[model samples]
Target: MTKPENTGYDYDVVISGASLAGSAAATLLARRGVRVALLERHSAPETYKVLCTHSLQACAYPVLDELGLVADIEKSGAVHNQARWYTRWGWIEPRAAPTGPALPFGYNIRRSTLDPLIRSRAAETPGVDLLLGHQVTGLIEEGGRAVGVTASTPRGERRIRARLVVGADGKDSAVAKFAKVPVRESENTRFAYLAHFRNLPLPGGMSHTWFLEPDMAYAFVNDDGVTVVAVLPDKRRLPAFREDLEGSFLEFVRALPEAPPIDSAERTTKIIGTVNYPLLSREPTAPGVALIGDAALTGDPLWGVGCGWALETAKWLAEAVAPAAAGRGDLDRALELYARRHRRRLRGHQLLAADFAKARPFNPMEQLVFAAAARDAAMARHMYRFASRLIGPRRFLNPAALARAAAVNIRYHRIASRTARRPHKVA
Candidate 1:
């Protein structure tokens, strides 16, 4: 709905792209008494992301819990808790300390399940209007600031005026483009392919990852006991994968250490793949508009971070703008705070993810830390915290943690050297 050519507006916050990030922010802000208009281009309620592994990091638990989604997610049969990783050194399984609290677990529900569930939650909330099939056409600019958006809906072209506008659109964000948000781009040298299988129960029913040097593969136990297996190999290996799609996918899985039994399992879905997704980072805020999720930043999906980051970034946006959206504060200051919070929480992880997307072997620090993680349960937990996006580099790669990892590796080497020199028992 259009507003008068003045300070009046239709919504407190008008968010484009009502997927995970947009729905989340909409729900949270509405709960805080802000009227929100959540818009999505896709008209079908069942249309969910197909090319995702659906792994949410443990760090996202608190946010999901606050949304009252954990029980429903669990009821939908989403796998809970830890992921076991395979490195050349060995497996790194997250372990709890002897006398502390158990770590929070992540989920592996399909996007087909998660997207609709969360979207429904937002639509049911008191102050949110879920506008489906509305394609964003442009932004309404007022004095060098975005005042709202114009969209082509099923009805007709509608102009929505709001105090704040949010772009929760995916990696290729139309809202970010319309706002001319400053952006930096990096290229990823790996290509990815993934599919779902049934009756593929993994060891301990946990999600597994293979950090095979420059290549990475995953087997996640999803809802209804289905497993999603994926491989992100160097771009150089793309031809072989494309040449024999099913054969290559199965071969990769079968070659992993203590791999799951995919041979007897039923292929329940088509192999989906993507090549050359750039590592994108855009300035999150400009005047009256803000961006969340992939609109703000999107890195290599090899780490399975998009879902968790989407939810968590929504939390950041809601928290930053709640007061302003409630008509109690300045919207621009809220945007600035949200921008600072976004950078502080995720920029380091973005940098590191971009570095690894180069498809090179692990750096010396990565090698040492990963090797230590494989051997030491504590180190595994520590590294898992970082890998899970629960902690930032400033904490994970600090001198103290590095020193501990170094000490553990040193001990492992000395023991290995002694054992090698001692004997083979003349077997």
Candidate 2:
């Protein structure tokens, strides 16, 4: 970390990175009239996250609505739909809404549009100083407490002090590194590849995911008749992907039980990809500083929770620290509160996501529950509650739910067996 000459304080909160999480924090904080310094490495407003499919889960609707972004996002032509999980047993889709009165539909928009839209919103908010082309280089610590950040911008090295510093940077966070925070990463056993296409046929404009056990694929409809097709194959298939990225991806998608129209669609963007996108969880805060978004926790990208979690964490942090920034409470206590809330809300979800990131086959219980979900509407709602992350694992897999799932599977099997045993009509 580079040390820079002392510079006078600029804002109450200095946030590193101007991606989804950082922008969201800046937006909310600025709205509350908290002085904020939002720094981004990139200079251009149009710059967007290249690797993301930008699927915002239904649970994030409230946060978006609170931020006043829902109307703009809808105007941008975002696709509204429910997620349909294609399992070996059957397709598990809830016919009714997932028991939410507010914006019941999840959204899929291209990151190229979404990121800039969010950044623009944040920049327009009063009390936010959006500084671009600033790359974080070090933390400014005073008496064991982080007071500010050092950055190298196009002009020169600069130092900006603050009451509190926020690490909204992505997984490889410079702020986290400077704070000496410990991060535990779960090994990612799968490699993912995706591309954007036009005129891709997505029935009902619904997001579809095929759980091929050890290999997975999906087709997500987005704005303006564009669709994103992605495939996640186990690491063992690396050589094949390397040999022919496009061919391998198309082959995998085409081989799905219910294939998408990738072969016929016009490929609009170059196929983008990533390897070993593991689940990472880091300490959310240290004295005088705090972390949000991927800086705090990053689960597998396969579940499409990155963008949603980024927005959610930003909202959480802003809510926690707003009163403190307004001089009504202790900043340290606010950070502690944020930490506890982060753990309570995301710990279980992260653990499950990390386990699923291993690319292993589903266990017996998962099979039973998924099969039951396909056969029974009540069971499907319960499954969606968990899938949409409205409920925790304990509630999702409670004794009663498990027993109901088991009963449904048993009845389904019995009916299938009876039909098989009956003599076929001769014609």
Candidate 3:
């Protein structure tokens, strides 16, 4: 382990990252009167990576509401609505499915805007100390347990000792690295390129996703008249993309027939790309530390599950670990329960996402269901429920739905075969 330059230890809970998961955890823990220190590598509170599409699905809204952020987010002009998915077959429309009274749909907010808002709120909460410009360089170990973090800042090296150390540092978490936790890689097929565009005419009040067989694209209307556009392609094509990110990204989105017409729109930011970052997780908890957000697990962005998962994990860990942190019970046992609950709640979603990311052209079953929805409003509603995460994969893939999907696939294939045998029609 690399030693930090300066070291003076203090604090009850030290968090190594100050992004979504770290900030959320700090807010909740501080509100409960637990002394918290949030450390971030960046000096500017406004500094945030502009990588995500920034769409928060409905599954995450409840967690946000519980954090007292829903109203603030809405006031910040976040878009709230179900996104419309356009496949080769047809459009999957939105439907209203109630999870609870206080929650109102999903939201789309720029991470650049949202990150600072969250961090500011966390700083204001009592019992929390926000330390910017501090980079965590090593973990402080006491008797083989992670008791704190050693970080370097402008003032030099300092050690923040705590009963618990939380690693919310994201996918490439240094905490995860230092702990020597094992990560199991999945078979990842898709690579993504994302950018923001201005003067793009998006479907009013709803986001859009176009599934073009092996390729997928999406656009969301976020705050500041900006639309977040992303293209997800097979991993083999990533090399060409890396060479000329902007050109390749535009071409990919333009090729999707269902994507918004953006030929005239101007790219407001440089295109960003991520390739082969497959969703994986080790044990999220060990000894005196716990991992949340992308540190715990990273799923396919195709579903826009990252932010929601981050918030959810923060809430779960906050509730699970608070009592133990307060000395009411064994902290180790609390972390074990947190790990079990986190896995149990998210295992189904992670498994499905991993399988889907293989990027095989949609199988017959998928075609059937999508085709059925094109022809039937009721089927579309069912599909919407699944897409919005109101229903699990098992319920969505029940016998009746599967049978209909299979029948549709067989019929579509026969038609395609006949069409291939015929002369090409003039446009």
Candidate 4:
């Protein structure tokens, strides 16, 4: 609970969280000569949330590359490539389709290994005063504008004043709550159970996911001799899952058509579960405060989009607010621009994510696409690009794409109908 000395308040921006988005913003802004105070409640640099499956998609690769951490991340146990999605119909293998470039793949790396690296990088940046173990209990307002934070630690309470306060806290952000920001809650109720295992034999260096009707499961293979596995189920089933997490998690994974390798692998970490309550802020910015990462918007984890979105938001906000924080433009104006840009860039994806989180079984069209992708290499590749988030959902669901998918579906159904007529062999 140790806190930095109260050396009086002076910083261009005071970031209230020290995880992914906050650290990224702190690093970028501080490197640009903007004085930053990066605060976190956790004292241990190695401490990280173990609930996430820790999969970063291709959409985030460019952001990491810009931060100059892509190489370092790759070296620190990142497994590259897209995933093989096992549908009830068939396995959708990776292939090239007619959507944009060959989908650039990304990696899977545990946060236990990734968060500390990024936090350390932020601490090393020249203009950032990294303050760990300090919990911001309240905000200091001046003329209706948030100008500083009042934090408490073992040393005592202290006020660190700054022109701007950034809330990079994760979903369920205390900063957002304290600021009384309006939040729009989605009714989609899903929960996730995650764990890590060693010696799981998976296909390629790729991650894998199973869209098993009402239940969704994922497996992420990292380079550190382990794979992360997770089960996401509708909230209605949460009671049974909570009764026996480890047993229920294993049972769920084993029930998938293409069962995960967890049964064969040795469990390396204790199972963790989190109730999924996807949320997004109605306003990402107020007078002198702004939110980023999950604090701004927490979409469903089914898409594995959280980490990428966090990095993307940090980069976007950094670029948008740099001139303002440096006194070249109005800070409020810059924050408004950041908010608009975030909505424009991610609204469509968020809508899609919320719709998918309902846990409803995939419709006929979805089944057709999965079945076709399993049989056609070209189709699989196109599907890969969409699944990797290279293309927006609109483009992926275009009329032409649907028509092609329909043709494939007809072929598969016809074959199945004929086979059913002659199916008399006992297994």
Candidate 5:
């Protein structure tokens, strides 16, 4: 672990934190022949983020396939799932569309397995220097622009320089902090609690989510016969959860209509919880520096979009900066393009996610749409697209779509009223 001697502008990009975002960016940049320094605090390759729900939504499938990791992941017994949403009105099951190219299905695998898989691919890439056990302590700035970083490692303190520095770190990012980036946060109204269970009598590889008024619960059937069950309740219910976590978790699960038979299942892991996780957004780009994944935007975990966003933002970064890093374009202009791309893709989604994180009851329009989705197959497809993040909030809630949903709801209520008034024939 001795400090290297030739450390002058050693790499094209020095990425902080070797999580999904950092590793993915390193792989993409390296494959394009750009030198990359990937810094990770965890020395072991197998170590992973333990609190993850381990769900990858369909939106990330193209990136996974492009990275050539999907086949290996499936071989490791990942579950391919389609989500079924349960509302108080009824259950809405979205069928895979029959049109242009089959829609992608989501995958569920433990973080213990998935994280190492991607990191191994990255470390083996041609020009990526995997600097394990390196913790970023501060940013190296020149002329008001980040040029490199100072990190503490087993060897000692070392300085590494690069043309661009990427903060692919998590919500509390050291690189972002050192660079003095501005972050805006919105208060979270609910807290999440979850655990893995075995032998929970549920359908195969299907995600079931129950929207019970203001509270929400989900059971995702995952690999190796394990199911991840999670609940999100308002902060006002914290006392009930703190009293007896196990007992209260069971009580809530049991209360759901047609709930999974968790009582017969064995708990495979200790209950884990995350409290007060606010919706966070930050300026994603600065001169000679950029942020991706949770470092850019951290939304509510109840939506399960974190992993997908991590992969997506990394790919976007590579598309924007790799050419410049390889000496084909201007670095400053590339960073600006990346910033605009980030907002175009995620800004609307982030705003909607922040509002939903408030845990408010469904509004009149939402109720109408949900009821229509339950009764109509076509409407369900729209709901699925929006939930999967395939479509933005503005497109999903357009005037034409809202008018159609209202009409469908009116038709459904008229049919129900007529059926109730009809007399039963005597046998």
Candidate 6:
């Protein structure tokens, strides 16, 4: 396509896919005085993604707080939860210790409430116009750069022109497809399933997980007296679950030590699940276009990193491009800045998550850290930091840190052996 002489744009930016990432980006960009057109294929305002467990990671709390949505989210009855992992050794639950601070907590509200709340906020923002039932069809290229999008709407089709086009869509992003973004794919060796239940209370309102090596189970607490029981077992066990999903899920959860009251709790939702989900990562930026959230990276769902990354990435994208979007600076430079930030922040975490998503036993390094964590509070905090994405993977994998964990684990085991050999006093 030949270069078209400069034409007027309806908005500064056109964002396709108005889910968490799309809507959040629209709000942030608009708040910075950049006009935005947010598009969503779903017409109903209340529609939410059912396939998700919808747990936000602690790393994202600051973003919510920054957006001034924390109070309203709490008012919506979202539960605050910290994670505890149950290994064969014991629960690697972190507490306040001399070596570090306490683990931060995150929110667990269903998507039904979260999606609409964020979308509504974007719609109400001064410079954002939320367009519903508008699915992206293609991009308008000028001088070999995307300058706008053509979307299929209820009436027919509309060409929305803008200086920049941002794709906040999902893993199967049409925006990315039209833009010809390069993709890096990884395989998922395990499948995931989840169901909601009532009358399922947890201690301290915290979430719990059992890491049974190749397979895993969880009882994640959510809002409105709901608990989301989920499992990510190896593909080898898929047949048993497929035969009887309810029975298999219940039996798996009940078999864990100190399990929730699944027998007494009433199942509220159907067995929502996904199999054959490949881990996906994409080049986040191109000429005149950018991608955020799942459109850029889709890690394994078991870790629940999607929601947190969505809000945080949107924050970064908006900050980097606000001046450009408002016509104050060069937009090309802004896209490059956002791309660098995205790769620097999330690339390592995404790779590590993909590696572990494969069905396999815990390697020696994993066992060493987990064993030490269960026996030592400081190690537990370190592991939690890594798992929470508060610290980078290198911090957890350094030779010095691994050696320290080994020392801690050996000391605890030696002391336990000595105590076991000692005769108990007669009572």
Model 2 segments more than 4 A misplaced = 1-8, 97-103
For residues 188-305, write the lDDT of model 1, one tens digit per residue.
9999989999999788888889988789899888998789999888989888988898899889989988988999999899998897788999988998889999899997888888
lDDT of each: 0.89, 0.86, 0.81, 0.81, 0.87, 0.88
Candidate 4, superposed: residue stretches over 4 Å from native: 1-9, 96-102, 364-372, 410-427
TM-score of 5: 0.96
lDDT winner between candidates 3 and 6:
6
Q: Which pairs of residues clash in candidate 6, taking residues 3 or more apart in a chain or in different chains?
A: none
lDDT of 6 at 53: 65
Worst-scoring 10-residue span by lDDT in model 3: 1-10
> Model 4: per-residue lDDT, tens digit, 363-426?
7767777778887776787788777767776777788787888788788789889998996989
Each model's RMSD to truth, in Å? 2.0, 3.3, 5.5, 3.9, 2.1, 3.1
Which candidate, 4 or 5, would have the higher TM-score against the true structure? 5
Task: Record all residue pairs in model 5 with backbone atoms less than 3 Å apart, i.e. clashing.
Answer: none
* Clash list (residue pairs), candidate 1: none
Residue 296's lDDT in candidate 1: 95
| Steric clash pairs (candidate 3) | 6-157
Name the better of 1 and 5 by lDDT: 1
* TM-scores vs. true structure, each candidate: 0.96, 0.95, 0.87, 0.89, 0.96, 0.95
**Model 5 lDDT on a 0 to 1 scale:** 0.87
Off by over 4 Å in 5: 1-8, 97-101
